[model samples]
Target: MTAALVEEAVKKAAVAWINVGAGPARALWCLPVDGTLIVVSGPGEQTAPELPEATRATVRLRGDTGGLIVICETAVARIAPGSEDWAALAPQLAAKRLNASGTADDLVARWENDGCAIVRLTPATDQPAAAPALPDDAQAAPPRETPARVPVRRPFRLHRVRRR
Candidate 1:
Protein backbone atom coordinates (compact mmCIF):
# COMPACT_ATOMS: atom_id res chain seq x y z
CA MET A 1 0.00 0.00 0.00
CA THR A 2 1.00 3.61 -0.49
CA ALA A 3 2.65 5.69 2.18
CA ALA A 4 -0.35 7.94 2.32
CA LEU A 5 -2.55 4.94 2.98
CA VAL A 6 -0.31 3.74 5.78
CA GLU A 7 -0.16 7.18 7.30
CA GLU A 8 -3.93 7.46 7.15
CA ALA A 9 -4.31 4.10 8.80
CA VAL A 10 -1.91 5.00 11.58
CA LYS A 11 -3.63 8.28 12.20
CA LYS A 12 -7.04 6.66 12.39
CA ALA A 13 -5.80 3.90 14.65
CA ALA A 14 -3.97 6.32 16.90
CA VAL A 15 -7.09 8.40 17.36
CA ALA A 16 -9.14 5.35 18.28
CA TRP A 17 -6.61 4.00 20.77
CA ILE A 18 -5.24 7.23 22.21
CA ASN A 19 -8.11 7.56 24.66
CA VAL A 20 -8.29 3.85 25.33
CA GLY A 21 -4.53 3.63 25.95
CA ALA A 22 -4.44 0.26 24.24
CA GLY A 23 -1.39 0.28 21.99
CA PRO A 24 2.35 0.62 22.15
CA ALA A 25 3.40 4.20 22.65
CA ARG A 26 6.81 3.77 21.12
CA ALA A 27 5.54 1.46 18.42
CA LEU A 28 3.39 4.32 17.34
CA TRP A 29 6.50 5.59 15.61
CA CYS A 30 7.54 2.17 14.37
CA LEU A 31 7.33 1.28 10.71
CA PRO A 32 7.10 -2.17 9.20
CA VAL A 33 10.30 -3.30 7.53
CA ASP A 34 11.18 -6.70 6.19
CA GLY A 35 7.85 -8.07 7.39
CA THR A 36 8.44 -6.92 10.94
CA LEU A 37 7.52 -3.85 12.89
CA ILE A 38 10.59 -2.01 14.09
CA VAL A 39 10.00 -0.18 17.36
CA VAL A 40 12.56 1.81 19.29
CA SER A 41 11.79 2.41 22.89
CA GLY A 42 13.59 4.25 25.64
CA PRO A 43 15.87 2.23 27.87
CA GLY A 44 13.27 1.25 30.42
CA GLU A 45 10.38 0.41 28.14
CA GLN A 46 9.49 -3.26 27.99
CA THR A 47 10.89 -5.25 25.14
CA ALA A 48 8.51 -6.81 22.64
CA PRO A 49 8.41 -10.57 22.59
CA GLU A 50 10.13 -12.30 19.71
CA LEU A 51 7.60 -12.88 16.99
CA PRO A 52 7.01 -16.39 15.64
CA GLU A 53 6.23 -16.06 11.94
CA ALA A 54 6.69 -12.33 11.50
CA THR A 55 3.14 -11.53 10.41
CA ARG A 56 1.64 -8.10 9.93
CA ALA A 57 -0.37 -7.15 12.97
CA THR A 58 -1.80 -4.24 14.93
CA VAL A 59 0.06 -3.24 18.10
CA ARG A 60 -1.51 -1.99 21.29
CA LEU A 61 -0.45 -0.69 24.71
CA ARG A 62 -1.51 -1.17 28.31
CA GLY A 63 0.52 1.51 30.06
CA ASP A 64 2.20 4.76 29.25
CA THR A 65 5.83 3.92 29.96
CA GLY A 66 5.77 0.15 29.72
CA GLY A 67 6.83 0.03 26.12
CA LEU A 68 4.79 -1.76 23.45
CA ILE A 69 2.56 -4.23 25.19
CA VAL A 70 0.85 -6.35 22.58
CA ILE A 71 0.89 -7.31 18.92
CA CYS A 72 -1.71 -9.39 17.16
CA GLU A 73 -3.03 -10.46 13.78
CA THR A 74 -5.28 -8.03 11.96
CA ALA A 75 -8.15 -10.48 11.99
CA VAL A 76 -10.23 -10.16 15.15
CA ALA A 77 -11.10 -13.77 15.72
CA ARG A 78 -10.53 -13.84 19.46
CA ILE A 79 -12.06 -10.44 19.89
CA ALA A 80 -15.83 -10.28 19.56
CA PRO A 81 -16.61 -9.43 15.96
CA GLY A 82 -19.14 -6.58 16.19
CA SER A 83 -19.39 -5.06 19.59
CA GLU A 84 -19.59 -1.29 19.93
CA ASP A 85 -15.90 -0.96 20.73
CA TRP A 86 -14.98 -3.44 18.04
CA ALA A 87 -17.16 -1.69 15.49
CA ALA A 88 -15.61 1.61 16.33
CA LEU A 89 -12.13 0.20 16.17
CA ALA A 90 -12.51 -1.99 13.09
CA PRO A 91 -12.33 0.77 10.50
CA GLN A 92 -9.06 2.01 11.84
CA LEU A 93 -7.66 -1.51 11.88
CA ALA A 94 -9.01 -2.10 8.40
CA ALA A 95 -7.38 1.07 7.18
CA LYS A 96 -3.98 -0.38 8.12
CA ARG A 97 -4.81 -3.73 6.52
CA LEU A 98 -3.68 -5.60 9.61
CA ASN A 99 -3.16 -9.28 8.98
CA ALA A 100 -1.38 -12.30 10.30
CA SER A 101 2.20 -12.46 9.28
CA GLY A 102 4.92 -14.85 10.39
CA THR A 103 6.04 -12.18 12.81
CA ALA A 104 2.53 -11.75 14.17
CA ASP A 105 2.07 -15.45 14.64
CA ASP A 106 5.31 -15.57 16.51
CA LEU A 107 4.18 -12.76 18.77
CA VAL A 108 0.96 -14.61 19.52
CA ALA A 109 2.86 -17.72 20.40
CA ARG A 110 5.14 -15.79 22.69
CA TRP A 111 2.22 -14.11 24.39
CA GLU A 112 0.46 -17.40 24.89
CA ASN A 113 3.60 -18.98 26.20
CA ASP A 114 4.02 -16.15 28.68
CA GLY A 115 0.33 -16.07 29.57
CA CYS A 116 -0.16 -12.55 28.33
CA ALA A 117 -2.97 -11.23 26.19
CA ILE A 118 -2.06 -10.14 22.71
CA VAL A 119 -2.59 -6.44 22.44
CA ARG A 120 -4.09 -5.40 19.15
CA LEU A 121 -4.61 -2.11 17.43
CA THR A 122 -6.79 -1.05 14.55
CA PRO A 123 -5.56 -2.74 11.40
CA ALA A 124 -3.80 -0.73 8.77
CA THR A 125 -3.63 -1.50 5.04
CA ASP A 126 -0.15 -0.26 4.40
CA GLN A 127 2.95 -0.50 6.51
CA PRO A 128 4.28 2.70 7.91
CA ALA A 129 6.67 4.56 5.61
CA ALA A 130 10.39 4.83 6.05
CA ALA A 131 11.84 7.98 7.50
CA PRO A 132 13.16 10.56 5.09
CA ALA A 133 16.82 10.08 4.33
CA LEU A 134 19.32 12.74 5.20
CA PRO A 135 22.32 13.68 3.08
CA ASP A 136 25.64 12.52 4.45
CA ASP A 137 27.03 16.03 4.72
CA ALA A 138 23.75 17.75 5.45
CA GLN A 139 24.35 21.05 7.17
CA ALA A 140 22.03 23.14 9.28
CA ALA A 141 20.31 25.87 7.35
CA PRO A 142 22.34 29.06 7.42
CA PRO A 143 21.43 31.11 10.43
CA ARG A 144 18.84 33.72 9.56
CA GLU A 145 20.53 36.89 8.36
CA THR A 146 20.63 39.34 11.24
CA PRO A 147 21.41 43.05 11.26
CA ALA A 148 24.87 43.91 12.56
CA ARG A 149 24.80 44.98 16.19
CA VAL A 150 25.42 48.73 16.73
CA PRO A 151 27.05 49.81 19.95
CA VAL A 152 25.03 52.47 21.75
CA ARG A 153 26.87 55.01 23.91
CA ARG A 154 24.78 56.80 26.56
CA PRO A 155 25.74 60.38 27.37
CA PHE A 156 25.71 60.98 31.13
CA ARG A 157 27.01 63.85 33.23
CA LEU A 158 29.18 62.92 36.19
CA HIS A 159 29.01 65.25 39.17
CA ARG A 160 31.81 65.18 41.70
CA VAL A 161 31.17 66.81 45.09
CA ARG A 162 33.97 67.42 47.56
CA ARG A 163 32.94 66.77 51.17
CA ARG A 164 34.71 68.69 53.91
Candidate 2:
Protein backbone atom coordinates (compact mmCIF):
# COMPACT_ATOMS: atom_id res chain seq x y z
CA MET A 1 0.00 0.00 0.00
CA THR A 2 2.71 2.46 0.98
CA ALA A 3 4.81 1.61 -2.08
CA ALA A 4 1.87 2.27 -4.37
CA LEU A 5 1.24 5.57 -2.66
CA VAL A 6 4.88 6.58 -3.05
CA GLU A 7 4.84 5.74 -6.76
CA GLU A 8 1.65 7.68 -7.24
CA ALA A 9 3.04 10.71 -5.46
CA VAL A 10 6.23 10.66 -7.52
CA LYS A 11 4.26 10.43 -10.75
CA LYS A 12 1.92 13.28 -9.86
CA ALA A 13 4.43 15.67 -8.25
CA ALA A 14 7.18 17.65 -9.92
CA VAL A 15 9.04 18.69 -6.76
CA ALA A 16 10.27 16.90 -3.67
CA TRP A 17 12.16 17.66 -0.49
CA ILE A 18 15.28 15.51 -0.22
CA ASN A 19 17.58 15.17 2.76
CA VAL A 20 20.97 13.66 2.13
CA GLY A 21 23.20 12.57 5.04
CA ALA A 22 23.43 15.36 7.66
CA GLY A 23 22.24 18.16 5.41
CA PRO A 24 18.78 19.64 5.78
CA ALA A 25 16.07 18.82 3.30
CA ARG A 26 16.30 20.82 0.07
CA ALA A 27 13.46 21.24 -2.38
CA LEU A 28 14.40 20.00 -5.86
CA TRP A 29 12.67 19.85 -9.17
CA CYS A 30 12.29 16.20 -10.15
CA LEU A 31 11.24 14.10 -13.11
CA PRO A 32 9.62 10.71 -12.74
CA VAL A 33 10.94 8.21 -15.25
CA ASP A 34 11.25 4.44 -15.37
CA GLY A 35 9.67 4.12 -11.90
CA THR A 36 12.27 6.34 -10.31
CA LEU A 37 12.78 10.02 -9.59
CA ILE A 38 15.55 11.82 -11.47
CA VAL A 39 17.23 14.97 -10.14
CA VAL A 40 20.04 17.06 -11.58
CA SER A 41 22.35 19.00 -9.32
CA GLY A 42 25.64 20.83 -9.63
CA PRO A 43 26.91 23.92 -11.46
CA GLY A 44 24.05 25.65 -13.34
CA GLU A 45 21.55 23.31 -11.71
CA GLN A 46 19.96 22.82 -8.29
CA THR A 47 22.32 22.48 -5.33
CA ALA A 48 22.40 19.04 -3.75
CA PRO A 49 25.77 18.67 -2.15
CA GLU A 50 27.15 15.15 -1.74
CA LEU A 51 24.18 13.55 -3.45
CA PRO A 52 26.26 11.84 -6.07
CA GLU A 53 28.17 10.01 -3.35
CA ALA A 54 25.18 9.31 -1.17
CA THR A 55 23.84 5.78 -1.14
CA ARG A 56 20.50 6.65 0.36
CA ALA A 57 18.32 9.67 0.97
CA THR A 58 15.02 10.66 2.52
CA VAL A 59 12.41 12.07 0.15
CA ARG A 60 9.26 13.90 1.14
CA LEU A 61 6.42 14.50 -1.29
CA ARG A 62 3.70 17.04 -0.70
CA GLY A 63 0.11 16.96 -1.91
CA ASP A 64 -1.59 19.56 -4.08
CA THR A 65 -2.77 21.41 -0.97
CA GLY A 66 0.89 22.04 -0.02
CA GLY A 67 0.95 19.72 2.97
CA LEU A 68 3.22 16.81 3.76
CA ILE A 69 1.91 13.63 2.17
CA VAL A 70 4.63 11.00 2.55
CA ILE A 71 8.25 10.60 3.54
CA CYS A 72 10.21 7.59 2.25
CA GLU A 73 13.73 6.35 1.96
CA THR A 74 15.24 5.96 -1.48
CA ALA A 75 18.31 4.33 -2.93
CA VAL A 76 20.52 6.71 -4.90
CA ALA A 77 22.21 5.85 -8.16
CA ARG A 78 24.32 8.17 -10.30
CA ILE A 79 23.75 7.88 -14.03
CA ALA A 80 26.93 8.00 -16.03
CA PRO A 81 27.18 10.51 -18.88
CA GLY A 82 26.70 9.08 -22.38
CA SER A 83 25.18 5.96 -20.95
CA GLU A 84 21.93 4.61 -22.37
CA ASP A 85 19.99 5.89 -19.38
CA TRP A 86 21.50 9.35 -19.67
CA ALA A 87 20.77 9.56 -23.39
CA ALA A 88 17.18 8.58 -22.73
CA LEU A 89 16.44 10.65 -19.62
CA ALA A 90 18.49 13.80 -20.11
CA PRO A 91 16.32 15.17 -22.92
CA GLN A 92 13.19 14.64 -20.82
CA LEU A 93 14.68 16.37 -17.79
CA ALA A 94 15.89 19.32 -19.82
CA ALA A 95 12.52 19.71 -21.46
CA LYS A 96 10.73 19.81 -18.12
CA ARG A 97 13.25 22.09 -16.43
CA LEU A 98 11.57 25.45 -15.88
CA ASN A 99 13.20 28.51 -17.43
CA ALA A 100 16.05 26.51 -18.86
CA SER A 101 18.79 28.61 -20.45
CA GLY A 102 18.99 26.69 -23.72
CA THR A 103 17.52 23.93 -25.85
CA ALA A 104 17.17 20.43 -24.45
CA ASP A 105 20.14 19.12 -26.43
CA ASP A 106 22.25 22.08 -25.38
CA LEU A 107 21.33 21.60 -21.76
CA VAL A 108 22.24 17.94 -21.97
CA ALA A 109 25.60 18.75 -23.52
CA ARG A 110 26.27 21.38 -20.86
CA TRP A 111 25.34 19.02 -18.08
CA GLU A 112 27.74 16.44 -19.44
CA ASN A 113 30.52 18.95 -19.91
CA ASP A 114 30.02 20.56 -16.52
CA GLY A 115 29.93 17.19 -14.75
CA CYS A 116 26.43 17.69 -13.41
CA ALA A 117 25.20 14.91 -11.14
CA ILE A 118 22.12 13.21 -12.52
CA VAL A 119 20.85 10.74 -9.94
CA ARG A 120 17.95 8.35 -9.84
CA LEU A 121 16.11 7.84 -6.56
CA THR A 122 14.31 4.56 -6.21
CA PRO A 123 11.98 3.88 -3.29
CA ALA A 124 13.59 1.32 -1.04
CA THR A 125 10.86 0.58 1.43
CA ASP A 126 7.18 -0.20 1.45
CA GLN A 127 6.56 1.58 4.74
CA PRO A 128 6.88 5.33 4.83
CA ALA A 129 9.29 7.03 7.22
CA ALA A 130 6.44 9.37 8.20
CA ALA A 131 3.00 9.91 6.77
CA PRO A 132 -0.85 9.92 7.06
CA ALA A 133 -0.83 11.75 10.40
CA LEU A 134 1.22 14.91 10.36
CA PRO A 135 3.67 15.65 13.12
CA ASP A 136 2.93 18.45 15.59
CA ASP A 137 6.30 20.16 15.63
CA ALA A 138 7.21 22.45 12.73
CA GLN A 139 10.30 21.02 11.09
CA ALA A 140 12.20 24.19 10.35
CA ALA A 141 15.97 24.63 10.35
CA PRO A 142 18.29 27.52 11.07
CA PRO A 143 19.48 29.42 8.04
CA ARG A 144 22.70 28.18 6.52
CA GLU A 145 25.89 30.15 7.19
CA THR A 146 26.55 32.70 4.46
CA PRO A 147 28.32 36.03 4.08
CA ALA A 148 25.11 37.77 2.99
CA ARG A 149 23.10 39.63 5.61
CA VAL A 150 20.15 42.02 5.69
CA PRO A 151 20.85 45.76 5.91
CA VAL A 152 20.97 46.93 9.50
CA ARG A 153 18.87 50.05 9.00
CA ARG A 154 16.19 51.22 6.62
CA PRO A 155 17.14 53.79 4.00
CA PHE A 156 16.76 57.37 5.25
CA ARG A 157 14.03 59.41 3.55
CA LEU A 158 14.62 63.10 2.91
CA HIS A 159 11.09 63.73 4.11
CA ARG A 160 8.15 61.49 4.76
CA VAL A 161 5.58 61.77 1.99
CA ARG A 162 2.06 62.32 3.34
CA ARG A 163 -0.58 60.06 1.87
CA ARG A 164 -4.03 61.38 1.21
Candidate 3:
Protein backbone atom coordinates (compact mmCIF):
# COMPACT_ATOMS: atom_id res chain seq x y z
CA MET A 1 0.00 0.00 0.00
CA THR A 2 2.77 2.42 0.83
CA ALA A 3 4.53 1.61 -2.41
CA ALA A 4 1.32 2.14 -4.35
CA LEU A 5 0.75 5.48 -2.68
CA VAL A 6 4.27 6.58 -3.45
CA GLU A 7 3.95 5.51 -7.08
CA GLU A 8 0.57 7.19 -7.55
CA ALA A 9 1.67 10.50 -6.06
CA VAL A 10 4.87 10.53 -8.10
CA LYS A 11 3.01 10.00 -11.39
CA LYS A 12 0.35 12.56 -10.59
CA ALA A 13 2.60 15.31 -9.31
CA ALA A 14 3.97 17.75 -11.90
CA VAL A 15 7.39 17.74 -10.30
CA ALA A 16 9.11 15.57 -7.73
CA TRP A 17 11.67 17.26 -5.49
CA ILE A 18 14.17 14.65 -4.44
CA ASN A 19 17.28 14.80 -2.30
CA VAL A 20 20.01 12.28 -2.95
CA GLY A 21 22.51 11.72 -0.13
CA ALA A 22 23.39 15.02 1.56
CA GLY A 23 22.53 17.17 -1.44
CA PRO A 24 19.77 19.72 -1.46
CA ALA A 25 16.31 19.08 -2.91
CA ARG A 26 15.94 19.21 -6.69
CA ALA A 27 12.65 19.54 -8.50
CA LEU A 28 12.59 17.13 -11.41
CA TRP A 29 10.18 15.78 -14.01
CA CYS A 30 9.51 12.33 -12.60
CA LEU A 31 7.73 9.25 -13.87
CA PRO A 32 6.70 6.31 -11.72
CA VAL A 33 7.36 3.19 -13.74
CA ASP A 34 7.67 -0.46 -12.73
CA GLY A 35 7.43 0.32 -9.05
CA THR A 36 10.05 3.06 -9.25
CA LEU A 37 10.44 6.76 -10.02
CA ILE A 38 12.55 7.67 -13.04
CA VAL A 39 14.09 11.11 -13.71
CA VAL A 40 16.16 12.37 -16.61
CA SER A 41 18.95 14.84 -15.89
CA GLY A 42 21.44 16.55 -18.19
CA PRO A 43 22.53 19.89 -19.61
CA GLY A 44 19.26 20.47 -21.50
CA GLU A 45 16.97 18.22 -19.52
CA GLN A 46 14.87 18.96 -16.46
CA THR A 47 17.56 19.19 -13.72
CA ALA A 48 21.10 18.03 -13.37
CA PRO A 49 20.96 15.94 -10.17
CA GLU A 50 24.15 14.91 -8.41
CA LEU A 51 23.21 11.23 -8.20
CA PRO A 52 25.91 8.81 -9.23
CA GLU A 53 25.57 5.18 -10.34
CA ALA A 54 23.98 4.13 -7.02
CA THR A 55 22.73 5.98 -3.97
CA ARG A 56 19.70 6.67 -1.78
CA ALA A 57 17.22 9.50 -2.23
CA THR A 58 14.27 11.09 -0.50
CA VAL A 59 11.35 12.14 -2.68
CA ARG A 60 8.97 14.96 -1.84
CA LEU A 61 5.47 14.96 -3.30
CA ARG A 62 2.10 16.55 -2.67
CA GLY A 63 -1.23 15.23 -1.50
CA ASP A 64 -4.66 16.06 -2.93
CA THR A 65 -5.07 19.09 -0.69
CA GLY A 66 -1.69 20.54 -1.71
CA GLY A 67 -0.07 19.22 1.45
CA LEU A 68 3.41 17.81 1.76
CA ILE A 69 3.92 14.07 1.22
CA VAL A 70 7.26 12.46 1.70
CA ILE A 71 8.45 9.10 0.39
CA CYS A 72 11.68 8.32 2.13
CA GLU A 73 14.48 5.76 1.88
CA THR A 74 14.62 5.59 -1.90
CA ALA A 75 17.50 3.81 -3.63
CA VAL A 76 18.83 5.79 -6.56
CA ALA A 77 20.75 4.63 -9.61
CA ARG A 78 21.65 5.87 -13.08
CA ILE A 79 20.40 3.57 -15.83
CA ALA A 80 22.80 2.67 -18.57
CA PRO A 81 22.09 4.46 -21.83
CA GLY A 82 20.60 2.27 -24.62
CA SER A 83 20.09 -0.60 -22.24
CA GLU A 84 16.91 -2.64 -22.19
CA ASP A 85 15.59 -0.96 -19.06
CA TRP A 86 16.42 2.49 -20.39
CA ALA A 87 14.62 1.79 -23.68
CA ALA A 88 11.57 0.48 -21.87
CA LEU A 89 11.30 3.53 -19.63
CA ALA A 90 12.10 6.11 -22.34
CA PRO A 91 8.64 6.57 -23.85
CA GLN A 92 6.92 6.99 -20.50
CA LEU A 93 9.54 9.47 -19.28
CA ALA A 94 9.40 11.49 -22.50
CA ALA A 95 5.63 11.69 -22.49
CA LYS A 96 5.59 13.39 -19.08
CA ARG A 97 8.11 16.02 -20.25
CA LEU A 98 6.16 19.28 -20.48
CA ASN A 99 6.58 21.06 -23.86
CA ALA A 100 9.06 18.53 -25.13
CA SER A 101 10.44 19.65 -28.49
CA GLY A 102 9.49 16.59 -30.54
CA THR A 103 7.65 13.29 -30.50
CA ALA A 104 8.27 10.65 -27.83
CA ASP A 105 10.67 8.82 -30.12
CA ASP A 106 12.58 11.96 -30.92
CA LEU A 107 12.99 12.88 -27.28
CA VAL A 108 14.41 9.47 -26.51
CA ALA A 109 16.80 9.79 -29.43
CA ARG A 110 17.91 13.18 -28.26
CA TRP A 111 18.51 11.89 -24.75
CA GLU A 112 20.67 9.20 -26.23
CA ASN A 113 22.56 11.52 -28.59
CA ASP A 114 23.21 13.79 -25.67
CA GLY A 115 24.88 12.38 -22.57
CA CYS A 116 21.79 12.46 -20.40
CA ALA A 117 21.57 10.32 -17.29
CA ILE A 118 18.29 8.53 -16.67
CA VAL A 119 18.12 8.18 -12.90
CA ARG A 120 15.88 5.67 -11.15
CA LEU A 121 14.74 6.20 -7.56
CA THR A 122 12.99 3.27 -5.93
CA PRO A 123 12.07 2.35 -2.40
CA ALA A 124 15.07 0.90 -0.63
CA THR A 125 12.81 -1.56 1.14
CA ASP A 126 9.49 -1.62 2.97
CA GLN A 127 9.21 1.96 4.16
CA PRO A 128 6.23 3.84 5.56
CA ALA A 129 5.14 7.38 4.64
CA ALA A 130 6.53 10.23 6.70
CA ALA A 131 6.65 14.04 6.79
CA PRO A 132 9.80 15.59 5.42
CA ALA A 133 11.92 17.82 7.62
CA LEU A 134 13.41 21.13 6.56
CA PRO A 135 17.12 21.20 5.92
CA ASP A 136 19.32 22.57 8.69
CA ASP A 137 20.49 25.54 6.62
CA ALA A 138 17.29 26.34 4.77
CA GLN A 139 18.26 29.74 3.47
CA ALA A 140 19.21 30.29 -0.14
CA ALA A 141 22.77 31.15 -1.12
CA PRO A 142 23.80 34.81 -0.95
CA PRO A 143 23.59 36.89 -4.10
CA ARG A 144 26.73 37.86 -5.98
CA GLU A 145 28.44 41.07 -4.87
CA THR A 146 28.30 44.05 -7.21
CA PRO A 147 29.99 47.46 -7.45
CA ALA A 148 28.48 50.17 -5.21
CA ARG A 149 28.55 52.93 -7.81
CA VAL A 150 26.26 52.71 -10.77
CA PRO A 151 26.39 54.37 -14.24
CA VAL A 152 23.33 56.04 -15.73
CA ARG A 153 22.77 56.63 -19.46
CA ARG A 154 20.93 59.67 -20.76
CA PRO A 155 17.69 59.12 -22.60
CA PHE A 156 17.65 59.91 -26.33
CA ARG A 157 15.06 62.09 -27.96
CA LEU A 158 13.61 61.35 -31.40
CA HIS A 159 13.92 64.15 -34.01
CA ARG A 160 11.24 64.57 -36.62
CA VAL A 161 12.48 64.76 -40.24
CA ARG A 162 10.78 66.96 -42.89
CA ARG A 163 9.03 65.06 -45.70
CA ARG A 164 10.75 65.41 -49.06
**In TM-score terms, which candidate is top?**
2
**What does candidate 2's lDDT look like per residue over 1-164, in tens digits?**
67787878888778999999778899999999866899999998999988899999999898778878788889999999989999999999999988988799999999999999999999886578546455666788888776786659977889987999
lDDT of 3 by residue, 10-38 (tens): 66766777776766667676777766788
- Sorted on TM-score, best first, the list reads 2, 3, 1
**lDDT at 32, model 1:** 35
Q: Order the candidates by lDDT, highest first — what do you get?
A: 2, 3, 1
After superposition, candidate 3 runs with Cα above 4 Å error: 1-8, 126-164
Question: How would you encode candidate 1's per-residue C-alpha lDDT over 84-121 as one tens digit per residue?
Answer: 53344333333333453446445434433444322333
Can you give the TM-score per candidate against the true fold?
Answer: 0.20, 0.89, 0.71
Model 2 root-mean-square deviation: 2.4
Angstrom error at residue 74, model 2: 0.2
- Candidate 2, superposed: residue stretches over 4 Å from native: 130-134, 160-164
Worst 10 residues of 1 by lDDT: 14-23
C-alpha lDDT values of all predictions: 0.35, 0.88, 0.74
| Candidate 1, superposed: residue stretches over 4 Å from native | 1-24, 27-109, 123-164
lDDT of 3: 0.74
